[model samples]
Structure formats: structure tokens, C-alpha cells
Target: MEQVLVEEYRNETLECLHRGHICGVGPDGQVKYEVGDADFVAFLRSAGKPFQAIPGVRAGIKEAYELTDQEIAIMTASHRGESFHLETLSHLMDHTGLEQSNLVCAESYPMHRGSREQIIRNQGHEQRVYHNCSGKHFGVLSYCKLMGYPLEGYEDPGHPVQQEIVETLSMMAELPADQIARGTDGCGLPVFALPLKHIARAYLKLSCPELIEDEKTREAVQKITAAMHAHPEMVSGTNRICTTLMEDTNIIAKGGFKGIYGFSLRQEQLGFAFKIVDGSDEEWAHIVVSILEQIGYANQQTIHRIRERFPSAIRNDAGKIVGHTKEVFHL
Candidate 1:
């Protein structure tokens, strides 16, 4: 069920007033518990990053082509467009003798407030690296270079890269392409369309591809997971939610804009995907932590720690501190 409520309360400590929208995925992995349709069609967004990074590893390009851990990390990232991320992107392009003109993504601002001012003051223009999906674009370039696929139409749905990704996801999820919610990601490549449950299944399958019938799919999953774990930082940045989520809890998690998150734990072999129907991303930490708890990876103590580390929005007004969200479900 999906739940959204308008509740009035006061924050006794901070003394502020505010409104709240709370949405979550509990330990049981229900798509929609309280409100409904939590399993509604979901895009998976950059959460699909690892899937896009697979071809490189499955083909043994990582071993024979000597791809660095850094490159592998970048391949699975939704970076902050920091100086370091941009530098790496440029270097990756240099390896292929290409430049900015080749990117298919629309230009945008930095995801990290950390680099916004410096970018403006120095460059007089927002750089493409700030688009957050630049590393993904660079990954496409790397694939094109490796497979000798024509670069001009690689971003189009009919291209070989898109076809491979679709085929891979189709076989892995045991679903047909038409059933998947295929769409153009913000970064200018075809992204699989799926409901939250299927999205979670995709991640879990990555964690345990032996469950999949295809041997190549199993190897692809293993390679991508190892590469991501080896270079966690490039998946996000210094303290990004995805990067920290991966490093701290040792879970494979990625966040998408407009409130979507997915993760899978290979040992127990479970999966989870959730979305806030009303489209709220501010409560990302709460959603993720609660999901982890539901999966048995965290207890009350861990929940308390995560909450303290990332406080919910509460404000104190005339009488009480107001809670910022009302996602009816709890961990």
C-alpha cells in the first residue's frame, strides 16, 4: 500500500513548523502497503548504472583491455560533476580520442553544491560533467570504442548498445522487452522501465545471477558487482547517499531523482525497490534506512544511529515541533 497523510505536530526541540510526506519500503518488501501502488511502474533511473556497466566486464575487456578499477567505478556512477569526476571523464575520452562534442546527454548543473560556485567563477559556464550522468556517457563511449560500434547513433534506441542492454535485462529478469518500461534516461541512453518489484528483482539477480539460467548473464553480474565494490567512490562521490550506502552498510544501493531507491544483498539473496508515489526525495535517508532494517541488516540500534546521523525534517511552531512527512509505514 502507498500512504500519504496530512498530520499536524510540533517539534519540541527545534521549534519549527512544516509539512511532511513520508514513503517507504518495509522489511517485508511489499510494493504498496499503506497507501497503494508502490510497485507502480518505476524507471530505476541511474539505479540501472551497474547494469549498463556489465558489457565491459562480461566480454573480458576489464582483464584483456586492462580497465582500471577507477574506470570500472566511473562506469557505474551517477557522479557529482566534481573536478575529479570531470578530469576522469576527460581522460577516458582522451583514451578514445574524443571530447565533449560526443556526449548525447543534455547539459545541466552540478549535483554537488560543493562545486557550483567554483564552476561558475572559473568557467563562466556550467560544465557537462555536472549533468550527473557524465560518467555513464563515458561508459557508452568506452563500449563503442571496444566493440567498434558506430558512435553516431549509439544513443538511439535501435543501436547495438541499447539492444545489448535490453537483451541482457530481458534475459536476466525473465521478462519480455515490451513488458519492461524502456525509456530514455536523463543521461541520453535507453533505461529499462520496470515496477519497483521488478527493479528489486534486477538487483537481486545481479547479486545472485546463478539463479539466472544464462551462464554469460551470471558472469556479467559477478564482474559488475566486483568492479563496483572495488571502486565505491566513483559510484557516487565523497559523501553522496549512494556511495555512503554502498560503503557503510555494504549493500548495493543507488538513488534516482523524484524519490526512488533500490538495493540487494547477495548473501541472504533478497531484493528491494521502493518509490514515494507523490515524488519526494528529501526523505531518502529515512526510506533507505527503513528498507535496510526491513531486510534484517539493521536493528533498532542501527535505525536510531541512521536517524540521528540523518534527522527527519521537524519544525517547532506556536505549540509543537511539526513532523515533515507522513509515510504511514515504518521499519
Candidate 2:
């Protein structure tokens, strides 16, 4: 069952509420705290990018392409198509010899406000290269090229690259491949569905790769997380939750298209996954801040930064105070 996690107040009266499930797993891989149905199953969405890029990393794409940390980090990004993101994508393509035609993600303009407006002012058209998932697609295509796999119909679930991605995610989540549900993503790639608890476990694995028994997988996880931490901006963009949370080196975090998010606290040895029942992302900051506060997170500065970037106070068109969002759940 869904529980109200956040409430929006207008003129001191409750105007709306956000209901969701949150699952937090301790170092032992057991659910330590939860609200609502911790067992709720949902699609991982872009939250699965880190694991999706693992196969490419394990295949030595970094070494083969001499890719920088920014390039590698972007592979796991839901970039906002800022200028920096476009530059990094170009660099990644140049290094790997990947063309825009190789990407199967839908055409779109930049997701960033200023960038989109700039494009519109110049009468620019939508482009596949500007799609947020283009980096993820590029990583897969790079893997296919290196492995001698066919690029045609690469989005098909039966493709070897896609199969490898599923297998990699299974290993990371500590769940059998057969037990994990699957569907196509908005970007034409397969999306994974798993319980919230397993999602936390997967993020925990990313944070503490030492817990992994397989050396190759462990190494890949380390590189991916490190890249994310080293270049947080490449992971998302300015003021984005993923970028903000990852700015704290101790935290490895990512969010999906819907209201889904996952993160791990390295020092605390805890992982958390949460989703808004209505698929709204508006309350993400409030929920995340509440979770950190409830958990007694060590880095107060990171929490402060998140609040500053995603303020709870609402403002009207003339900048007058209107309403505020409040976290209503504990743990």
C-alpha cells in the first residue's frame, strides 16, 4: 500500500500529497527501514544506466577508446543536453567512431531551459544526438562494435548486447535473471523491473564493490562509480538531483524518468531506493532530505546543498511566497 510521504500546503491548507514506497537496505543486504510496501516492484527506468553501462566497461571500452572519466561518466547519464554534455558526447563519439545514426534514442532538443531556448531562437531542429539517453545508447553501440556484434536491431531484447546487459544487472542485483521483469524503455532499450529492496541492494553493490565475489564485475563497478563521482556534472547536469547527490563523493546516486531514485552511502554502508506512486518527481528533494535526516547522514553539507538547489518554498509569478512542500513520512 502507498503511504503519503510528502504534502504540499497552500495558504496553510493541504493542497496535494505525494505517496510512495521507500526501501533502505543495510550493509548486510537486509531491509532496515521502509515506508509503504517495500516490496513494490517498479521499472528501474534511467536508474538502471549504471548497470547498463557495466557490460561495456567490462569489455574494456575505456582502454580500447582511451575514453576519459567524463566520457565514461556520461554513458551513465540522463544528461540535460547542456553545452558541456554535448561536447562530452561529441568527444565520446569521436573517440569510439560512433555516428549519430548509430543511436536509436528518439530525437529531441536539449532538456535544459537555456539550451532549448537557444536552439529555438536559432531555429534549430530536434536531433537524436541531443536525446538524454544518447550517451547510454552510444556505450552499448561501442560495446557492440568492439565485440563484433551487429548494430542492426541492437535494441531487440534477443540481441547479445542486450542479453549481456540483463545478465550484468542480474548479477549486480543479486537476483536471478528469470526473476527480473523486463520491458522496453522510452529510448528503445530494455527496461528492468525489480522490487524496491533489490534496487537498494544493487546500489549497495555499486557503493561497496568489495562485497562482490567476482573480480571483473567488482572492477567494473568501481570504475563506473568513480567516474560518476569524479565528474558529477557529466552524470547529469547543473542543479540536477543526480549531479547534486553525487557531488558528495561518499554517495553514489542516480534517478530515473519517473519518480524513481537510488543511492548508496559508502561510509554508512546503506542503500536506498524510492518511488512516488503517482510517478511525480516534484517531491524528490523533500523526500531525499527527509530520508537523510532520518538516517542521521554524516554529511550535512550535502543535504544543505540539495535543499538550496531544490527549495521547498514555492513562489508565485511575481516571486511572492505561495506554498511549501513538507515531508510527512519518517524513515
Candidate 3:
């Protein structure tokens, strides 16, 4: 528990922290942890993005909105807020008849410390549109326009866009609307809060969409999964782990709003979900690295490349990791 807390409680304080979060599902389709109720509910934040985009995909606006697969992949993303990030998001906005100034997301800087500085030096101001969730916000706008739903209050849980999202997610988890808790997302939209098990179930369902009786939903899932694998780099960005791993492999990979991470291992017909005890975006390396190791994706060269892309730092006497963050993940 203390080890997990180490990632969650990075900011030192006097209080003893008792709270923690979740990890992957066991073979039995239940989460394997004890810190929180394995079945307790919480918001998926951006983690629910891909699932939310399902309705839009089903409505047939991918190319009509001029969306690429990578755009579609991170449309469900909490992106890194870099230049390509800005381009894709801005393009999505223009495609939907919204202005760059219309975005309401609270400003978020790049998760990559290096990239954040570079972006700021180039732009000369803080930018909310460049925030990773911007693509998602643009997506909501597109969904509203394409579906003829009011863009006003579209982010509200009661709005048609969110309603479609809820229905799709609820159906995927085999739960009803009331069984899911709805909350506002970082992007100012209603996000679903479900049990970790159900979140895992959603990924499993994505990998195994044949279980979905809805033909349109099932077909859309297939298309999104195919596109994610086909254009992994676009889904994430250059040198990003999600982009690298998903592009190189057959998994349907996506990172969620906060610290939630999920993927569907297509060949194995399995899926995984983990919510970092803290919503630290950097902790993604720890969780995903640990998962790759557990799932036998242990190629030395592959792991080496992956680690270099998002190296974890463990400090020594001076709190420096020699040159990199030492990967430490225990399943």
C-alpha cells in the first residue's frame, strides 16, 4: 500500500494518507486490489472518451468531419498538448463551425515538462485550446452539429451528446443508466463514474464487441479499433508510448481524462484497466510498463524503447535518476 501511495502521494504532507486506487482485472473479470471497493464507482474522466465517441462514430461523421484515425483515437484522449495536438484540436473546431476562442476547458499545460516549455516559448501565452482535452471538446461540438442537437449545454449530462454516451457506456457494461453515476468532466461534460470492474468490462467489451447486439454500435467499435491500430502515431503523437505501442501492436489503446488507462489486447481477446491511485499522467508509464511485463510483452528491445520514450525517474543522493526514471511497477 505504501508503495502504491508513493506514486499517489508525491507531494509531502503531515497527514497519513489512507486512500488508494485500482489496477488491472484478474482472469475472473474482477479488479485485483483492496484499497478501494473493487466494485465502487468513480468517474472515468477522459478514460471514457473512446466509449463516448462511439455514438458519433455510429452516426457516421468520421470523414464528414474530416477526422483521421489518430484524431479519432485521441478524440477519446487526454492528450499531451503539443503542436500536432493543437492542429488536430483546432481543425476539429473549424470543421464544426466553432472558433478557437469558444472552447471552455480550464487551461492545462503539457504533461511533458519539456514540451510545455517549448509550446509556451513559441505561443507566448497560456492556451486552453492546446490542452489535451480540446479534441474531446471539439468532438462534442461536432456531435451536436452532426446530430442536430443543441450545442448549448451539450456538455451537460442531460444533453443529447452525453445521453448517447451514457447509453452506449451503460450498454457496454451491461448496466442501466441509474447504475452508473454521472459527473462533470474536466472538459465540462457529463462523464460516467462506474465501478472499476465495469470500466474493465467496457474495455473487454471493446475487444469483444460481438457481445453487443446493437449492430451499429458494434460496427463503430470495430472501425475505431481498426483505425487506432492502423494509425497509432496519430492516435497519440511522435515518441508517445500509447502511439508507439498501439501502432506497433494490435491492441486498442487509449489513455483517459486523468490517470485512468485502458487497452484491449485483440489477439488475446482480453482487456485491462487501471486508475492510478493519483491522477498523475506520468504514472501512466509505471502502470503500462508493469502491464506489458505481466502480459508477456517482454521483448528487451521493445521495453528498452518504451522506457526511453517515457523514462521513469528514481532519485539517488541528489534525487536524480542518473539520467532517467527507473521503471518500478508491481502487479
Candidate 4:
């Protein structure tokens, strides 16, 4: 139960430190590697998007709408709101006869810097579809439409869509529905809280859908994961860690708000998750790279690619090398 020092920021000296927990579990729910308390409880945040999208996929939304792999990827995405992301979302809404007005997520600018700058140059206002979580909201609304459920209170925990989300998560996590704690997410939807291990367990099933009992759920999981792998750009965007990592490897990775990251190794059938105590998203990539290297899931070349793309090097105004962040943890 030892807490590990996950990252360190150094200038002329060590300027900051981040401590967190990392847990790796096999398919059987046995802890294969641990840095700190694997049982630490936290909200899954956007890391739960894939599971949340399960209900829609299981309800035949994909087949009914003739959704493409790119569309399915966005349904489980925390996209950066680039033009392509916006276009894909618009296509989905158009197909369903829904509009941006139906989205429960608040209006926000794109997370992609270039896209944001372009929108600003055009004097464009923030829109609900530009929100990073809009695709997830769309998934919920699509589920409501497919199931003939009411759309007004789809965000409510008592809503059928929310209940189905909870049930799907419980089934995947192998935990009872009542034991999962509930809270509101950043996007105005219910987010579930459970132990880190259970989250890992859910990712395990995501990585290997053949383990699922229900044929429909299993197929949905397979389709979603395949879509994520095939179109990582739709899942996030250019230069995003989740997108880059999934693009370069066979694994499926997702990062949630508040410094939580989860991934499942397809070859090894292993699920891994971690959380930074201080919730510093900047430190996530370094920690994940370290974990993959430590566990031998990724080779040195892949690690080098990630570091090159998502460098933790700190620089000054002149672009001089001022400092850098280093991973300090090991399995």
C-alpha cells in the first residue's frame, strides 16, 4: 500500500511533484502490479464513456442509424471539437432528426487550439456541439429515441437512459448497481464512482469483448473498440495523448477529467488505471508511458514516439530548454 511518486518537475531544481496510484489487473481480477492503494475510489469521469455508449450500441442504434465506425468512435469519445469532429456529430444529429438544442452539455469552445483560433477568427460563438462531451450526450439522447424514453430529463439519475448506463456498468464491473456511488459529471450527466480495480475490470471487458455474457453487448464492445482503434482521431484529435497512444499501439486508452487514465492491453488481456492525487492532467502522459514500459506492454520505440509527440519538456519564452518532467514511479 505504498504511494508512489509518479512525476517530478525540475528547473534549476525540483519545482513540483505529483504523487498518485497505479494499478494493473489481469482478466481474473488479480492485481498484477500496484504502486499505491489500488482500491482508491474516484469518479470515472469521461473514462466511462465507452461503457456509457454501450446501451446505445446494445439497443441497435448503430444498425438503425447505419452508423459508421467513425460515428461509433465519436459516441465513445472525448473529442477535441475539431472541424471533422463537429461535422461527424452534425451528421449523427441530422440522421436522428435532432439538433444542437437537444444537447444537455453547456456551450464551449473547441479544445483543439487551431480549431479554437479558427472559430475566434470567424467571430463564431461557443456552441453546445463544440463541447468535448457533446458526443456522449448525443449517445444518451440517441438511446432515449431508440428506446422510446422521454428526452426532457434524460440527464436525471432516475431516467431510463441513466439506469441503463448504470446497469451496463454494473454488469461489466461485476458489481451490484446499488454499491456504485453516483454524482453529477462536468457535462451534466450522472457519473459513477467505484474502486479503481473495478474500473480496471470494466476496461478488461472492453479490451476483450468475447468475455461478455450477452451476445449483443459483446458485439457492441467489439465494434466500439475496433472503431476506436481504426479512427483514433475521432476519439480525440491530433496531438492528444489518447489519440496518439491508441494510434501507435493495439491498446485502447482513455483519459478522464481530474487526472484519471485507463487502458486495456488487448494482447495480454490486462487492464490498467491510475489517478493523480492533485488532478494534474499534464502529468498523465508521462505516467502512462512509464507504466507501459514497466509492464512490458509497449516497446522502447513506442515509448519514444509518445515522448516525442507529448513531450514533458518545460521551456522558456525564447524556447530555451528550461526544465523537464520525469517519471519517478516503477511497478
The lDDT of each candidate is 0.66, 0.92, 0.67, 0.86
Off by over 4 Å in 4: none
Q: What lDDT, from 0 to 1, does candidate 2 have?
A: 0.92
**lDDT tens readout by residue for model 3, 1-331:** 3244323223333222223354455434566533344565667876677787788888887867777776676566667775666666666666667765656777767765677898678875666776767777776677778878877777677787887888889888767888898777666778788877777778876777776789999999987777767766656677776776675455666776556767766555556666655556666665666567766773556566777776655445986543333334445
Clashing pairs in 4: none
* Most accurate candidate by TM-score: 2
Candidate 2: residue 64 lDDT (0-100): 96
Question: Runs in model 1 with CA error above 4 Å?
Answer: 5-35, 298-305, 313-327
Residues 129-218 of candidate 1 have per-residue lDDT tens digits of: 567887777777677767888878888988888788877777655568779877777677887767666676676676666776677768
TM-scores for every candidate against the unseen true structure: 0.82, 0.98, 0.80, 0.96
Please give, for residues 1-331, the per-residue lDDT of candidate 4 as tens digits. 5465554555658788788888889978788888888898878999999999999988888888888888889988999989899999989988777788988899999998999999999999999999999998888898899889998999999998899899999999888999999999999999998888888889988887877899989998988898899999988888788887887546888889998889888788899888887887888788888888777764567688788987878887998878888888878
Steric collisions counted per model: 24, 0, 8, 0
List the candidates ranked by lDDT, beginning with the highest. Answer: 2, 4, 3, 1
What pairs collide in candidate 3?
46-257, 47-256, 47-257, 70-234, 70-235, 312-325, 312-326, 313-325
lDDT tens digits by residue: candidate 2, 180-230? 999999999999999999999999999999978889989998999999999
**Candidate 2: Cα lDDT at 66:** 97
RMSD of each: 4.6, 0.9, 4.4, 1.4
Q: Please say which candidate is ahead in lDDT: 1 or 2.
A: 2
Best by the lDDT measure: 2
